[model samples]
Target chain A: MDTLINIPTMAELSAKGEQPDILFWVGCAGSYDERAQRITRAFAKILKHVGIKFAVLGTEEACTGDPAKRAGNEFLFQMQAMGNIEVLNGYAIKKIVTACPHCFNTIKNEYPVLGGHYEVIHHTQLIADLIAEGKLVAEGGAFKGKKISFHDPCYLGRGNGVYEAPRKALEQLDADLVELKRCKSNGLCCGAGGAQMFKEPEPGKKDVNVERMEDVLEAKADIVAVGCPFCMTMMNDGVKHVEKEQEITVLDIAEITARANGLL
Target chain B: MLAQIVFTLVFIVAVALFTVQVRKIIRNIRLGKNICRNDRKAERWTTMARVAMGQSKMMVRPVAGLMHLFVYLGFVIINLEVLEIVLDGIFGTHRLFAFMGGFYSFLIGSFEILALLVLLGVLVFLARRLVVRLKRFSGVEMKAWPKSDAIYILLIEVLLMTAFLTMNAADYQLQSRLYGHYIQAGAFPVSQFLSPLLPSSTEALVFIERFCWWFHIIGILAFLNYLPISKHFHILLAFPNTWYSNLNPKGHFSNMQSVSNEVKAMLDPSFTPPPADPDAKFGAKDVVDLNWVQLMNAYTCTECGRCTSVCPANITGKLLSPRKIMMDTRDRLEELGKAKDKNGASYHDGKALLDDYISREEIWACTTCNACVEACPVNIDPLSIILDLRRYAVMEESNVPNSLSAMFANVENNAAPWKYAPADRLNWAQGDWSKE
Candidate 1:
């Protein structure tokens, strides 16, 4: 296993009598799912490169309970949500940045109703803010002139309406940033939302991810840039379905930025 | 005198029939669970004005919107003349509002013009369904009674408008001959064209006028009763449905209170959580588990297929059709309603909306995208019903798809929907930090 460096947990920071600028919410997918773990690392590298003080919850972190809630397991969802909120409140966490749309959506929109209110932002927004503030610089390295089409994740695009931040982060790559036909508000789901990601699709004429992949193919881009980890999985599977895995690559916006900025 | 007596009997019978049907509909709608949407009176009224009264959302497609607006306005405004017609029938008078003189002329002339417009509107609507075969209207759900019901409504409108115009034409001809109680008070510009072709004899003119007059009144009553069973129930229910629409952000889902209480017990340090109720259901399992507003929504759907046309799931060839969801709810409710009537208050059909009316495939196919809710001009929410049913499948029945089972297990065991433990969450952060 590749060892991570210079990361601190809430407990470790408290033991050192210090606090970071922001709490990095390494969501379950980003923590465990191998492909998504790269996205987590890419975003963390950006924060480190920019010299922003950030800390993760380490063993104290739990799932944000989004999948449980959406899957209709209210009992399980509440159990998970309350557990995370208790730990968050214990750390007196204020600002949180997450790489997962599922976590961002649940904590930002849902947690407040359960009395766990805090400033929550997706990593794209944080990176975009960092760029705008001149704290970090991005450049078009390997991606210059590359045709990159963005796949808007439901939780990020329609659910929360943060359509531009990821695109803005992509603009730093100086790539041909193309949009799918069903872009922005009308963008289709990757057949992975509503807990559908965890199960086989009900028999249908076509899988929703394959249908959405048609849009990605229609964009005729070399790279399918995504924000959410689930979308990354769905789109990657879609590319492989068409035997175009070698031609098309699915990269999180953070991963692309980290690579372009030579922080990898 | 015999004519007046017969008219009174017809009116009494027609109204009683219509009243019974409406009561049955209200009772069926009340079978669903209660949800309080009475707050925000000002916002609700504004929504009614904009959506129902102004017909704003319909204007998204201008051609259909304008055509529908004509039919809607003609139906509501022309009914004002029904009041005068009923009075004339009851009291043995002719053109009862004729005493209002010039104002009566304006009202009569307006009704004549509107009658022609309504006739034109229904004809175009019929042609669209029968000739043009709009894809939305031709979908599988529209194959049987739904197809015939639409044609029937348009055909009825055509007949009703024809009867109205024929009555006006006969009255005009009778007025020209100075027939009994036929006054030359109101202008009938459109029907006047037909006045010349009518028989010149006074009694014959009176006979034609009387037949049409009786037919028009009876037809109107039948149409009112037919509305309870037809998709045209939207004519009566749209106003309330639009007024009761959720004003929250489109993506916001209603949190279950049962879940909230448990979360509170966990979050608040001093408070102890109550033991889980053994019989407490997590989400909707049947029609009765759904809120009254959702039931009202099912009743209000026009079956216009606007929602299905815009749905990503439907368009992408998924089994899910938002329109089908609404139709299935309405059908199930009607089934339950009839059983209640037949069984004299102890009715159990031993069937439900889930699996029987709507399939697990249909509910699972939806992305919960809210496109259907946005597309519905009447603000009928199909997404809510789908979510509730999915909740039943996952929580109550434990019949979720295998992949979802795996994901749920991950969430239960690892605080997320992945198989990773909490300690390694930041493993991705480990790399050369100062090399850059």
Candidate 2:
């Protein structure tokens, strides 16, 4: 935890006439939300620990227009998209990684049409790859024998067909990875997607996150692992809503891997 | 010869009525905005084959899948016998294809078996709807008509299959008795069991056979006409619906080219703007505003409610039911079609799909999770229609919830959904992990 990690911005790297291996897209929630910031740090720490050269956009990073697009402001979404694409294309960035599924989805899938194309990947996919490459040796330090359920982020799982990468990262933890009744392609949304995190849920019998929490509790999982920052916030709020924060813990897959590897 | 002439007239009328109804549906679908889904012909064929013909998506629920497969196969295979019926009716020949010998026997035997399977499938479907009462069948949108429509189709299948088997049974009895024109032609595996139930009188058997033959053929023709108005139209539309599926990654919502052009002009001084049509709208306000594929999706939806069952908004008790969205679209389209027919093409009902049929509450409740899209067996994209409605609501009407308005303002001014400064974006990296 006390290890010195070198963090460089894309501007700093460009100033030195050097380019990192990848540009880490720290999304709006990752940059602004306190809880999501921890996930961003954990993922960055993993990248640093694995000796992967990566740089952050820092002040140059803006919203990927996911919320605006989903919330029905196509004009606003395009403006934001064009701005981010210009910055990215200017950097001549070839590959990108993000802890947020929304950013990963937008940049990887949606941005190409607007003249910005990069080999975008989610943080979990990168961790899975690192583990596969033996660059990151994940040991089950605290999570061993504990029942961990992975909550699929809508954009990452159903939206983008990435179901296994996060689970692969969890598999290395040597924990009992129990699946929620609805997992993978059928995975339920955590209610924070489609910009719902910004607004109160339209009145219903229960909040969508609260409904998803029931799935986790039904599995009797001691820990709920997530891949997206939005899901992280929603699942955490769900735990609080159920007053099970004392018994059940919610952590992002990056944070879990970071903890299990004793990097945090 | 007189009987053949009367049969030909009846067949012509049935086919003509069916053609008229189908043409109306096509016209209604064409009323929608044009979208190019014809790209990737090879992929579309594969999708149609896999999703519609192969019932690939149906396998999500094994019980319903298998039952549906039985009915679907039976319905398709047994319909081949209709060709012989049509030929015989035109030429005044009994078992016109009976000269094919063993192959004809094999075909008749297969049809008999398929008819039995169709009966079993229809019964199970009825039981699922009436007795077990599957949750997918019962929704707020499933009122008297929708519920009965399902039952009626199942019951119609039962009656049709019964008439076919009864016709075969009488034919079998007459053939065994060596009655006139009742030639020993085709095999009857299933109807052989029913031959025992018939009377020994040859004339009575012939009368029974003739009655069932007319009934079965007329029922099938009536069923053909019934398809355009019924939810059962999916039997035909599912193929094209799956073919023209939104093949992009489910996460990738389509970018509006019109909005893109306007945004480019705003951002770049050198960018040229296209001459705008005064009537151009941001997104769908009514059925006519939706893309043709989306309109076909409305026609393709059989009210299975698989989309609603998997929808997070619907599952958590929100008002958004994706099945209802498709149903409402189809209903509004039908209403508009009828209005146009009456009012000569410039019909205005003053009601749009957005407010009148689909509510603002239902529209706002969606999380855009694509669960409904993933759940649809025929690849019906209720999410696309929902998103289009959302676009209209936000872009044209500027109608949004208070919280979303604030989020929009933040994204507009501060470059994030929250009120945080862009300068503080890198603050997360400065966090002292050493404190832990």
Candidate 3:
């Protein structure tokens, strides 16, 4: 028995509306993580504020088999992915937007191997677009007083090459931003990916999250904003564990954007 | 004279085995034995070259690269000494060109100095393994592990170096005895150092020469016998493996061998043709599941641990240690040969198919990341084997995880990996981009 999580393709989804053509994917990470949900709704609000018609994928949104495939459980990945293909096939889906980097990467890079070709886009890409379009103008706006920095989730940055989108979105908001020394392609894993969200980290050196948190504190940024749900969960949990020394807030990039728009 | 005879036989045997293996590899190809991938053969060969000879993977970690470069160069240069020793045994003299002495002397001297440097390099390598404590297989400390192959090679190098030094000391004593007798050439630094200590007898020099010669020759012979079994075996296998590598682009996979051309009228149209096996009943499940050249990789592996050291899954602490996957297969193969009927491997209790041979999680952990395949120096294609097993698991066994289950259905039914309205196939190109 297979349960299908079907999300429409970007093009079919994009044709549903007009400008702010966001091709959003309901990543498995988003399905489970609260932070990811917050960020996206905020991003959606901001995009709406900027007059972008974000077409939704309807019932077609599902897991993109990245975790299942990477986890070496191709059967589960395929079953879940089939549901997606069927849904996308039912609609002329176009232009994708998703909060999770894993989803972004999978739908973008891996979908073609299985024949699910689409011009996929992450939510950050749309935010970057909205900002570039001068529609979601947040410059010297919402988040002006908050000192923040971005965590390039592996799936988003290194996994799919969205290295600049998340930063650009924040720049559009004119948030006080700082960069971690180890950012971009060299970005460290939150140690919570590839269904690692469910497994325990090996008992060796430091927790990868804490290690990453220390890097954020070292960057001296007050808030650590991320686009990936897993990163947010790990970083937020890590903040509580290491909160005695520094007061660091771990928010999803969407949440940061939402705050910029005074939406959430 | 006894040493000379033994040396010749050992050399002959080693060379013979190496050539036969290489030649059989071509025959094996003609017979289409280890065609283990769906990727183009040319592509696989290219990956092998770029990884093996080009050392593309080694550059990932700088320290490891420098260490391997020295070790690889040492093996190449030390080979000259092996040839020299063999020549000495046959000709009753160590020098190949005796009358033309000056250049020859310089060549041997330079070799000895280089060998000395390599010997020192060996020490540094040992120190790194023992002191630096690199994690090789599954976070296991390599230094503490019983690396029989590496340990033995290091021992041989030390023994050879010691033998050379001792023979030099004794040879100097004898050479000084003839210092005045053969004073035609200008003084040599090495000989001059031993001049005062030499006893005035050419017999002593000859005796010491013969003694050092015996140790060096014996060491070479012993190493030859171990070539097919030891980690250093890549020394013999690397040359040909690199030379005949599947040279193709990285992105392409070998085309699957179409079974319709090979098999005739079948017993059952629905039998699925058994996935291209001649015996159809006996199928490969592991490294021994491989043909000779692949199994040959067992001996060919330098065990530089370069594959394991750089594997993305391994670094991420997944169960698929590419090095372990190779070493385990080699170990299992050896176990099979040693078994009473060469079939004593406990495939089931070992979870031979999935969990034990390679953990399901470990196998799944591969992002299909070519990091390990790209990292191996001797051209071992772990990725190919992994994918092959995946194929078996997917097509025949239907053992894929639930995630892929949906995708497979989507592929077979919808003809696309993602869900879309069948009528709206052209929607991807219709998206508006300027609305932001």
**Top model by TM-score, which number?**
2
Candidate 1 at residue B343, lDDT? 87
DockQ (model 2, Cα) = 0.73
Q: On residues B1-436, what C-alpha lDDT tens digit does candidate 2 reach at each position?
A: 9999999999999999999999999999999988998899999999999999999999999988988998999888887899989989899999999889999999999999988988888888899988999988898999988888998899999999999999999999999989899999999999999999998899889999999999999999999999998999999999889989999999999988899889999999899988887888998899999999999999999998999999999988889999999999999999999999999898788888999999999988999999999999999999899999999999999999999999999999999999999999888877467433
DockQ per candidate, 2 decimals: 0.38, 0.73, 0.07
Report the lDDT of model 2 for residue A184: 93
Better of 2 and 3 by lDDT: 2
Best by DockQ: 2
Per-model chain B TM-scores are: 0.94, 0.98, 0.74
Candidates ranked, most accurate by TM-score first: 2, 1, 3
Question: Which one wins on lDDT?
Answer: 2
lDDT, candidate 2, at B361: 94
lDDT of 1 by residue, B1-436 (tens): 8889988888899889889988888998998888999999999999999999999989977878988988998999999999998888899988888989999999989999999989888888888898998899977689899999999999999999999999999988888877667878898989999888888877888888989999999899888888988999899899999999988755567778777776676667787766777756767877888999999999999999989987767877777889999999989999998988998766788899998889878887777666688779999999889888878887778998787788888778866676776566666666554443
lDDT per residue, candidate 3, A1-264, as tens digits?
112212234455446553334555655445334455455555555655665555555334555656545534444455555557666655545566677677667666655554467787777877777668766655546466767888877666645556788888787655678888657755666766645554454433455677777778788787887887778888888788787335677777676666665555
> Which portions of model 1 miss their true places by more than 4 Å?
A1-8, A16-22, A41-54, A122-151, A160-185, A216-225, A242-264, B98-117, B169-208, B260-280, B316-318, B433-436
lDDT of 1 at B58: 92
For residues A135-209, write the lDDT of model 1, one tens digit per residue: 766788899999999888888887788889999888877789899987886677787877777777766677777
